[model samples]
Target: MQDIAVGGSTVSRTDILGQVEAVGVGSFWATDEEGRLVYLSAKALDALGGGGESLIGRPLVEIFSEVQQANGEEAQRTLGFQLRSHSRFDNMIVRVDVAGDDETGQRQTRWWRVSGKPYKDGNDRFCGYRGSSIDITAEYGRQLEAAQHSQFDPLTGLANRRRMGSRLSAMLTACKGAGRSCALVMLDLDRFKQVNDTLGHPAGDELLKQVADRLKTVIKDRGEIGRLGGDEFQIILPDIDDRGDLTGLAGRIIQMISQPYSINGKRAIVGTSVGVAIAPYDGVESDELNAAADLALYAAKGSGRGLCRFYTADLRESAELDSRIEENLRDALVKGEMRMNYQPLVSPHDHTVHAFEALMRWEPEDGRPVSPAKFIPIAEQTDLIVQLGGWALRQACEDAVQWPTQLRVAVNVSAKQFMNADFPKVVAAALAGSGLEPNRLDLEITESVFVGDVEAVDKTFAALKRLGVRLVMDDFGTGYSSLGYLNRAPFDKIKIDQSFVHGCTEGGTTNPAIISAIVALAKALGMETVAEGVEAMDELALVTERGADLIQGYIYSRPLTHDAIMERSGTENFVFPPSGPPRYRAGRMNFFRKIGVIHEDHYYKAMLRNLSRTGAWIEGLAGVPEGTDLILDLGGGQLAVSKVVRAAEAAQGLKFETALIGDGNDGLMTRHRVSPYALATAGMPLAALPAGSYPLAEQMSASRSPRKFFEVEV
Candidate 1:
């Protein structure tokens, strides 16, 4: 433009440009044909945070890069690429990200918008470029920050639900095209509501933050985790199809998140149930995979809280059963379908009954017997546990009052019922109504009851103790409760968890040590210790030697009805000897079902007589030698490599080469399963390989090889 005339002088165009450089509004620059900086304004030198002489010969493109767009797509042309092409460009946003590039040290990244064109020299050859740049750091930074806020959860700084969904969709699409697999894990906190209800919403927020942190640590760089509102979360684990790895990841997640949290100076404990689904096997799309993972999580919760389960086709049936179970459970009390069976807690020293634990049994109207493992979690999720627990306490007390005066009865108290303000009153009412002494009632509680306000929990415990009822911490030494809690609560007894009791007698196990420590801890505190689930003489002997004060399990007797107790009480036949297996067997389920046994290329039909994590019994196969390596196809894509340990006639005992993991329903399953990719590679159609059927992956099904053993019908 034209120069401006002042009062006594005229301002030249060069002088106006110098004023522009002095104000830091914009900067002028020129590059040689080699794209090296030949001239730069003083403002540009300040922006580079370097001396003018030092930056003169440096490549201009080295000092700047194109700003990345909001979307994750790569830029078609970078500034360096464009500059090398000798092409004109306009209004391109660029960023300087070099360390120590800021003059004031207040900014690490400087944004610029510039326009430039190729210029020719005296010889008519391309020699340089001249450009001007305006600082856009303020506006561009705000845009980037806003974009970040939209994609992440403010509290945990994890991806939000929308971003996680988009990521899963994209990953699944990419994996499907590449013939890879992705795993989706769904989970939510258990009993988190009790924390919020007792401690307040702020503490709940703190707990969620801690949980998110633990998830980050456990999953670390392997996947993306997102909070889908409330206590629910979803994880996208890319390129993982092996159930073995997924099992480990899900386990670590549950273990990490289930640890105790100190929120607002109050201790809180919550558990998580994880459900895993793999793409192309469980589903090929995002929605399908999510639904599958959700169903698996439902099954995990149905089995019980604090477990992990993989998606299976049968979970759909289980979902329906859960619905039916919940419906029937609502009317179970009114229909008189619920009953109590007392399992005697006997003194191991005298083999005499010290007390009976009142266990609730419900026989539904449909005549199907649903285990507590499947239904109690459902009840806890709703308000049914409180009602059922109230009824159970009254019924158990009423039944106990008829027994001999010296014997007391223990009744299980749910965390839901225990946390209620009126629970102590409920216990008093049950005792007064049944005419049973207050001391005759033992209130069974678990560590989960200590999840909320510390003062409130202490007050409840004090109130129960004031009523003269004994407090027995059920499932003690199960990693849920610490010794510090024992000092806080007044417990008359501690029942060692069945988990420690089951394998105590086996060598190389820490259960014996844990049992000893528990018994010692209880004795030191003047509290009685009962070894629960002592189903074998060895287990009984081990516990008795470890100073356990009582034993309560099948080793003495199964849970008996009131009539059976009355019949036996007349004769005073309380002194019973331990009657169980002579040794501790690795607790196998008597799973009698048809399965397939593959040895080499020959597939033999066999009957699975029993199944355990370590081994299984198979029949319907003859002439199979011991130490023979075989693969047992236990359906559901489970192929267990095993060796015949015991061979007799048509019966054989097979030891698993690799032990199976929990199916999350108290059953054993192979950790790694045959994937669809492997099936497709073997030229087999994508079909379900289930129990009771043998489809030899199509390629091996047409083998003309001779059979190794005769397959007889069992």
Candidate 2:
């Protein structure tokens, strides 16, 4: 061994090499032209848990199985590629499997950064390469943590907005290139702000974590879910284009998320509204699709939250309609455009009116009646509901005071109004100011009031109870129906939701069973039960037979105006005899509008008197025979194929070939209509379909026969 002088001391070559190896800053390694390891430092071999002699003939690339770029994406240049090309590489990060011993004795993964330079013989032929390697496992882990922190929500561990945006963009691009479809669902949590305000943000954070877990369970392997900041979430489903399947999934999500959650030992309930958009059909790009889904979500929330909506071309109009309604509703209270209509609830035992439900109706200044279904939800979304609800309470109380009889007046209260701290005081003021007996006033509330803190809900109930007023559970068995609510809240009556009454009398419907059980449960609880929406004699008989204590529907009378109720109240006793259809059938909507009917080569104009899912009655068709096939054009390119089932004097009942589906609004519509694409193919301009008439006239060349029936003015 030779001695080397350094600074102020002399050291042997072996001692200097030993000092360099002990520091363990890095290790030096060499490979043959075939990329086989020829030399490895003893220190490196020790770190790898092997002797340098044993790894002498192993392939270098085989030791490092995978390589990744600095940004965490898979590297374009693999270790094998670089080694086979005999090219020099610098600072390449690679993952290697190392032998290790633990209780389970499994192989452990380790990361390394290796830099190498290729060497060649004097003949300019590649011979071997040398490289220096450093262990980077800890630093790689820290980088991974930082990357995840940037990409995921800290509270829920779900992907954040940036990551979701990137993922959606990439997925949409790939789906467009492959000519496939992707479904994106955007959801916003309902009543989540109440939770945050009531239980504090920590509880809200816990609720969010639980929600994320439920989402993962529900969407397992089928899609990816991301929390897009706050209470909004986005889900991406690839290759799923079926609306039916998407609807089912969205429903599951809504139902699952709406179920009761326990936060910090207190029960909290919230709901979610989902809007879905399909790629290429709804939009081709990420931003466009996201906006479409957001608009659909807005529509869902506007159509009363806790629901799901699939995006359609008509949603833009619906969104605009909602904006208009919301704007109008803000001024409706001051303008006196809102009124109360009373619907009598009659006892099934004696058919005498037991009470009247005060339903709110909005007669806008434009002379059009806006359905409560449309504007009530809008009011609830803001402070307008508290004002509207207070007005209704006072009006109902005053109206009941004028009645000769002590008939109870049931005033509906929204969840938002009920959650207000001064709600009970408002009720007291209504009763005191009207000089009405509190016992004659019933406050109808839904299950949503139970969503807040138990102490708060209980306090409200106690305060209401102190006022000597009757509390009724309205819309029972509709949403979040729990016996626990029945056990906790002090309710005097249970009003069956109209949905249960719709098909209860029909064959093969489990609604009868459900109604029977509800009636039984209400009876056992000593609460009065009223079955709502009894439109026919059969439905009435079924509910009466099922032991419902009272009934309210068109079978008795539609919502009556104040004058009508006052006129009836003048009598000693009032009883509304059940007057409606003899048999229970699908609901019929009356419309006196002219529609085009096609028979053979003649287009006859007829009046649509009434319509149902399966059939319709049209007048002004003089002599249409039985089994005559006809096409009824209901405008907007909706053509229904029908056959005359019954003929009469200038009128006929036609059975449709296919049943109509719901129009999202409370109307029936044909499933498929003439697409703008079809209109374009028929020589019309290529553009979106406009409202009103369908552009089918230009394509039809058949001659029209003379009108057989005189056009009767409606």
Candidate 3:
């Protein structure tokens, strides 16, 4: 058994055999052209537990027979046929069951797959098969469980959404071939959110599982039932004969779901609203039918729960309206029609301009202004909100560049926009494009955005914060109100919705109380509150008294254009004279000596605002506090006052008279302006009047026709 050198190894045949036997896996031999095992390596023997020496010179059939009954001569014949039919087999697998030792408490034997490949001798002749037996029972079990889970619900072990999808696909094909109608029913458990919110999530989960079980029982042998996800489930009814069948099935489902569910042995009642759409009647296509079913589901929910709704053309029309709005909104952005309107946000206390709230407007060429309520939902539905919101942000930033650097601009962002994958990029683009400081921009998002995927939103919000931008949760306490969001997401400000603000306003004093509550809540959260829809003076005062940080609405101004805002803010310093009927005066009033005696009726109540003599201002006016020179008529004559004594309401002493700086005798004589009484000396004496300490008009007193004062001055 001495061997010649092969591949730089000079050893005896016995040494080569010993080396092959030492391999960790196993080696084996077979002699017949059919490749039956004639020998087994030591490792192979150990692998089979003390059978190696005994198995030498044995046919493979005899060896495998003890391992598995399925591995007899018939199996060998099948393997021979396969080897002859095909080329060299790789990873050829087979499974055999073997019993475990008694100590392991084995009842049923487990199965494994054995992989083998034909081995050959140096003469290129077939020798025997050599391979390893892998215990793949666990892996095979996992694969089976995974397959089952793919088709079945994890909670109730009923079929799941994936299985429903496959089944529906097949059903549609079958229906198409037979020209039959099938019904797809989708159900959503109503009041599910309240249950989840008031009770615990674990309780909700148990209820859902119980609901699923009830649905399974109700739909048994009728059709397939599946848990679509969350509190949603689906049913597929094939071969629907009539509308009544579907209604009956839906009725049964509602009845079953309406019953009390025992969650942790606690009785809880829940109901479902079912939506049904039939193939060939509602829609010919599967997806269309499913969409119709969803529309019907929405209608069912809209009509109130514990009922069902069938898809109708009207629902499609409403759905189409949504579609058209969404499509048009997307086009509006492309067409350069989507614009931002700047509604001045005023300080409620002083009515001083604080900032502008950038409101979105879609002004079509042919129609009136499209309300945000009309188009905003469309943007949300079509996800055009992300684009429109970005455009608004850019426009606001650009407009802010023209404003006082201290003035911030706020742009609202919908949940759809805020949740966009590229929201950060969109904001960065806007800021870069407008060259506006990020700190001057506020992004308002509703509370809905913070409800789900909070981690993603948190990270995005943090990124926005790093850019020196402020984030506000708008319409707080409206939908899905979660205090947990404040604890999680960083909110710099909060907007009390117009509904709440308007309600408070109508409630008057009660309104202030509500505003106070909201303000207090905001302050506790370290947030500022901006009262929306502050459309009346009283409302403004009320919100101011309640400590609202900001106020915005029509009471101040409607949304203005960029040019209008620039004009209002820039040219606002130049003062204008009053426009009213001029009085006939008999005086060339020296401009410096002329104190414009403005009567109470001559000035607007807005102009009769709070002030002191030393350039103090009306507290509630929307513009600059200081007054400039203006012409005014005191009913006796018109004079140019260098400044106004725009006195406070309390300062209008007696008849709300203002002081005149000079004597009227020479002042009136320069022009054709006359007064009823003449001035005198001693103590400011009255001429041609009755002898009383106060001046009085005499009966049948001498009168003179006065010339017009403007012509006389000219």
Best by lDDT: 1
lDDT of 1 at 432: 92
Q: Compose the digit string of candidate 3's lDDT tens values, residues 617-662.
A: 2222222122433333332322223353443322221111233322
lDDT of 2: 0.82
All candidates: CA RMSD (Å): 4.7, 7.0, 34.4
Find the 10 residues in a row with the least total lDDT in model 2.
683-692
- Cα lDDT of model 2 by residue, 158-195, tens digit: 88888788878988999767767788999988888889
The Cα RMSD in angstroms, rounded to one decimal, for candidate 3 relative to the true structure is 34.4
* Model 3 worst lDDT window (10 residues): 663-672
Better of 1 and 2 by TM-score: 1
For model 2, state the Cα shift of residue 268 in Å. Answer: 1.4
Best by TM-score: 1
lDDT of 1 by residue, 1-714 (tens): 598898999989878898977877788888887889888777777766753456678888776687666543235665776788888888888876544634664545678888898898688899889888888889888877876677778888888888888899989889868878889999998888888887889999999999999999998899999998899999999988777778778778877876778876677888888999888778878889999999999888766567789998888998898888898899998998998999999988889998999988888777877787777888987889999999999999888888888789999998889989999999999999999999889988987787656678899999989899999999886545468689999999999989999978888999889998988889889999988999989898999999999899999989989888788778878776779998888878997788878766566778999998999999999999999998888876688989999999999999999998777777778877775446445543223233323344545444456767998878
